[model samples]
Target: MSGHGEAQPMKSRKSGPLRGVAEVPGDKSISHRSLIFGAMAVGETRITGLLEGQDVLDTAKAMRAFGATVTRLGEGAWTVNGVGVGGFREPEDVIDCGNSGTGVRLIMGTMATAPITATFTGDASLRKRPMGRVTDPLALFGARAYGRQGGRLPMTVVGAANPVPVRYALPVASAQVKSAVLLAGLNAPGETVVIEKEPTRDHSERMLLGFGARLSVEKTGEGHVITLTGQPELRPQTVAVPRDPSSAAFPVCAALIVEGSDITVPGVSQNLTRNGLYLTLVEMGAEIDFLNPREEGGEPVADLRVRFSGEMKGIEVPPERAPSMIDEYPVLSVVAAFATGKTVMRGVKELRVKESDRIDAMARGLEACGVRIEEDEDTLIVHGMGPGGVPGGATCATHIDHRIAMSFLVCGLAAKAEIAVDDGSPIQTSFPVFLPLMNGLGASLTAG
Candidate 1:
C-alpha cells in the first residue's frame, strides 16, 4: 500500500543554451543491484554514489522489510548488513517498489526461490507495466506468480522450496528479464544459463561477478550465453556507482543543439555496452571529445566536453546498438530534429513497452514542433531540420513519463518559438535535480 501518493501535473517552457558542468546522479541500474546484492551477502556491503531518486529509495525500504539492515550514512553513502545468501526472512508486510520496474522485477527474482510468499505493488505507471515478461521466466524456476490481468502489478509471488535452475533464451532484448533469472538462479542447484540474442545492459552479470558469485559470460555464434553457478556463498564488497549516462544525455544533447553553448560532464560511464548515443551523435557530426578517459568502479569513465554544432547530419542507427542506448532514444530523437537528412532508428520494438509508448510520444511531440517523423512496428525515422531550422511553438503531452517531459524541454532550448509540456512532475522519479541543475547551467526553464 505504499504507492498512495497522487500524481501532480506541471508544465515547462522554452529555455536557452544550457551551459556549465553537470554532475548527474549515480547509475540507477547499478544502484538497485547494489542494494539487492548487499542484502544477500554475508557481511556488510558499503555503497557510495547511490542514486537518491524515489525509485531507488523504495528499493532500500524493500530490502529492510525482507530482514536486511539498510542504513543511509550520508549523501550518496549507504551500508547494508546482509542476511546471507539464500537466507531471506518472510516480510511481515507487502513490498512496494514505487515507479521502478527494475526494482520490483529484480526483487521478485531474488525472493522467488526462498520458500516465502510476498505481495508486491507499485505506482499507477508501474502497475500498468507488464510483469509477465519477468513472471513468465520466474515460473520456469518453479516459482508461482499470480497478478492482475495482463500480468500487471499488485501481484503475489510464492517462492519455491526447491527451485530448479533453467536455461532461458530471451525472446526479446530485456535486461530486467535477464537479471531476474540470474538472481533466482543464485539459490537453486546447478547452473542457470541465459542466452540473449541481442545484448542488453550487463550490469547484473558484472555486479554478480563483483560480489563473488560464480558467473561467466561467453559470446556464442547465436548470442551472448551467460552461465551462473548456483548456491554460492556471496561476499560483500564496497561499491562505487558510476554516473548515469542516460541522465547525462539531456544536458549533452542540449549543449550540442543550443547555439553558443559549451559544457562538460564529468565521470560519465563510457562502457562500450552503454555509450551508443555518444557514438551515434559523433557520427552525426557533433563536436564532442572524451577527455581523461580512465576506469572507475570497474567501468570506463570519461569527461565529456560538448560544444554547439551547427552542421549535424543524420545517420541510420544500427539495430545492434539498441541495447547500448535504449533509454536515450527519447533524447536522441530530440537531437535528430536539429540535424540534416533523415535519422532512421530500427529494431526498437521495445519502445512500445517502456514507461510509455516512447516512439509515439516522440513522434507526436516532434511533429507538433514542425519535425516530420514516421514509425512502424519496430522502426522510427526522423526528418531533420538542418541547424536552427526548427519552428517549435508547440505543447507536448508527457503521459506521466519523465524522459518524455525532459526530452521535450530540451527541444525548447534551441527552438525559434517557446515549447511546453503537459506534465513535468514525473522528473522526480529519476532526476529530481534536473530543473535546478540545468537552470544553474544557464538554461531558462520555468515551471508554468
Candidate 2:
C-alpha cells in the first residue's frame, strides 16, 4: 500500500515578489491514461513526461499486476509491454491503489469484461470515497461488484464471462465515470454508446482514437453521444504528455495575488475542457498572456505569462464550466480572497465528493484566515478581501486532499500573517515537487 508517512505540518509566510519560470509536472489525467492504455495495447508503448506522483504511480503498479510489464526507463520515461485487450491475467494479490480514486476506478472498468476476478483497496481517504458511480454502470455490462455497504473500496469485481455492450447516460458530470464506461466498452462485442448531458474531459476519447480504436463522437440535441466499437487490436505509440494545467494552477494563481509577482508557465495544456480556471482568472482582470499557442501530444498547449494585478474583480463562474474546472475551485477560491467583490462558484456539487468535501474544507479554512465566505450544497460564494486584505494566521486541516493543501499554502504567500496546513503530506499524491517549485519562485514555505 502507498503511504505518506506522518503528518508534516507546513507553514507559509508573506513573501516578496515571485519571478521565474514554473515548469509544473506532466498532466496527471494523461499520465494515468497513458499507463492504462499502454497496458492494453499489443506492443511496447513508450511514454515521456509522465507524472510520477503517487496517483499515477499506483496506476503503473496496477498495470503491472494485470500482466503488463511496466518499467521506468528513467525520470519521466516509461515503457509498457502490453498484454493487449481482453488478455489481462488475474492478479495474485489484492490491488492496493493507495490514494488514487482515478487509478482504482479506471482499472475496475478495464478488467470488467475479462474473465477475471480482482479485489481493489486504497488508503483511508480513497476508501471513504463512493465507488458506486463506476460500479453501477459496470453492472450494465454484466460485471458484478461486491464491496462494503455504500460501494466503498476493498471491493471485488467479478468480470463477465459473456459481456455485452451497454448504453449509459451519465447521471452526473464526471470524467472518471465517463472514462470507466468507455474503457469497459473496449472489451464488449458490439458498439457501446455513452451519452453525457454535459461534456466532460475528452482525454479518454482522444487517446482511444490516437491508439487506433474505431470510435466516433456525435453531438445531438441530447448532448455528446460517444460510440466505441469494442475489442480492437490497439496499436502502441510513443506518448509525450503535456504539463498539467491543474498543477500549474497553484503557481499561476499564487502569482496573481502576490504583489509584484511575475512568472511564466511553459507547455501547459490549454485543452478547452481544462482551461476554465484560466478563463475565470482572466474574467477577474488577471493580467495573463497566452503566449505561443500550439499543439503537443494531440492536445493544445501554450505558455502563460502571469503578473500580479491589484485590480482583479470577482465574477460569477457559469455553472456549465464546473466539469472542466472541478479540481481547481479550491485554489480559485484562494485567488478570490485577494480580488474585490464576491466570486461565486455554482454547479459545483461535485466538489463535495472529491478527495474531501472541498466546499466545506475551503470555506472553513478561508473563514479561519479572516475571509468571509458563504456555501450551501451546490454553491460557494467567496467574498473577496481585496488586495493584501487576508489576515492569515490559522492552521487549516488538509483532510488528505492535495489541492486543499497546496491552495492554503499559496494563500499564506500573500496573507498578512503566516498560514499553516495541519498536514502537507497529501500534496505528494499529485504535485510532489510543489514546495520546491514554489520556493524556487521566491515564495516562503517551510515544513516542521
Candidate 3:
C-alpha cells in the first residue's frame, strides 16, 4: 500500500541477456478466491502455492476478521478453517484492506447477507477507486451500503437480516464485480443469477464448484448467464494454485526484447481468459515455445521457453480480446515500442479507472521515455521504434501503479539510456519480489 513506507524510487538500465529459470509467484486471482471460498466452506481448506503479495495477504486478513481461522504454515502453505455459510461474525474493528480493491469488494459480498456490519477502508490509491459498482449490485440482495460521495471506501456495509436472492446483469466487464455478486449470493435464499455480456476471469466460478456449490453457466441470446444455488454446504478443498501469467508476462516479455536472451518460465497458467498477451506476441512473430501443456488446479498450465526475437512487427490487438488481457496492456505497450510497426489497442476505456488512468499514465510515461504515442477515450496507439530504437532517458511517474512502474523498468532493459520510475514500492502489492527476481536474472536495477 502507498504511504505505508517511504517512496521507493527505482531505475533500470540496458543490460545483457536475461538467463536462467524464472519461477514467478502463484496466481493473484486464484489466491484471493482460495481464501474467500475457503472461509465460506464448512471445514478446513488447505492451500499450497498461495501468492504472498500484499493484495492477497489483505484478503486473508479480512477472512480472519470474519471469524475464519486463516493460518500460514509455511512459505506458501495456508489453512483456512471456515465459519460456514451465513456464519461470519461482526468484526470488532474497522476492516482495512490496504490497497486491495479485490479484498474489500469480495469481502463485502461475503458478509453482505450474514447480519454483520463491516466498515472497509484502504490506502490512498484504493480510497480513490469507485466501490459503487460493487455496492450497487449488492443492494439487490437486500444489503445496504453507505459510503463517501461516489461510493468510495471508508464505507460501511450493513448485512441483510432477511436476505433474498437476486437476478442482475453487469453494467461492465469486471471479474471483481462479477465475483462480488456471486460471493454475496452464497448466503441468500434460492438462486442468485448474474448475466454478463463478456466473460472475465472465471476463477471464482471454478473455485465455487470446487468447494461443492451448485453453479451453472448457460449461453443465451442476451449473454452468458450464471446461476448459483444459494446456501449450499461448501466443502473444504486442498487447492494447488497455478503460477500467475501476469507475473510471467514481465520475464517473458523482457526476454523477447533483450537481444540473445532466452529464459524459461515454469507452470504459467494458460487459461484462455488470460493469455491474450501471449497470443498477440505470437502474432507479432515472437519466438516463444509453449512446452509441456497440461492441466493444474482445473486450469491449463504451460512451461514457456522464450527467446529473443530480432524480427517483430506490431499488429492490431482485437478489441474483443481486451477483457482477457486488461492487466497486460501497460507491458504490451512496452513490447510494442520495441516492434517495427504500429500497435493499436481499442476498447480499453476501462484503463481509465485502474489504480491510475493507465492509458494516460502509460502514454505520458512512454512519451517521456522518447517513444511516440497517441490516445483517446478508448484507444491507445503506440508507434513502434523497433529493437533498440527508443532513447529512454526520462523518469516515468508510476502514479502508485505497479504495472506502470514495472513496464517502464522493462522498457529500460533494451533502451539506449536509463529509465526511472518515481515510485517502485507499489510493485509489492502484486509481485513482492519483482526487483530481486529480475535482478537475479541479470537485470541492472538500482534504488534511485
Which one wins on lDDT?
A: 2
The CA-based lDDT of model 3 is what? Answer: 0.92
lDDT of model 3 at position 133 = 95
Structure candidate 2, residue pairs in collision: none
TM-score of 2: 0.99
What C-alpha lDDT, on a 0 to 100 scale, does residue 120 get in candidate 3? Answer: 93
For model 2 the local lDDT of residue 268 reads: 77
Question: lDDT for each of the candidates?
Answer: 0.90, 0.94, 0.92
- TM per candidate comes to 0.97, 0.99, 0.98
**Residue-by-residue lDDT tens digits, candidate 2, 141-220:** 99999999999988999998889999999998888999999999999999999999998889999999999999999999
What is the Cα-based lDDT of residue 288 in candidate 2? 97
- lDDT per residue for candidate 1 within 1-448, as digits (tens), equals 2453554444344555667899999988999999999999999999999999888999999999999999999999999999977788999988998888899999999999899999999877788899999889899989999999999889999998999999999987899999999999999999999999988889999899999999989998979999999999889989999999999999999999988889999988889879999999999999999999998877899999999999999999998999999999999998999999999999988887887889999999999999999999899999999877789989898876889999998888888888888878778778888888888888877776
Worst ten in a row by lDDT for model 3? 1-10
Q: CA lDDT of 119 in candidate 2? A: 96
Ranking by TM-score: 2, 3, 1
Question: What's the alpha carbon RMSD for model 2?
Answer: 0.7
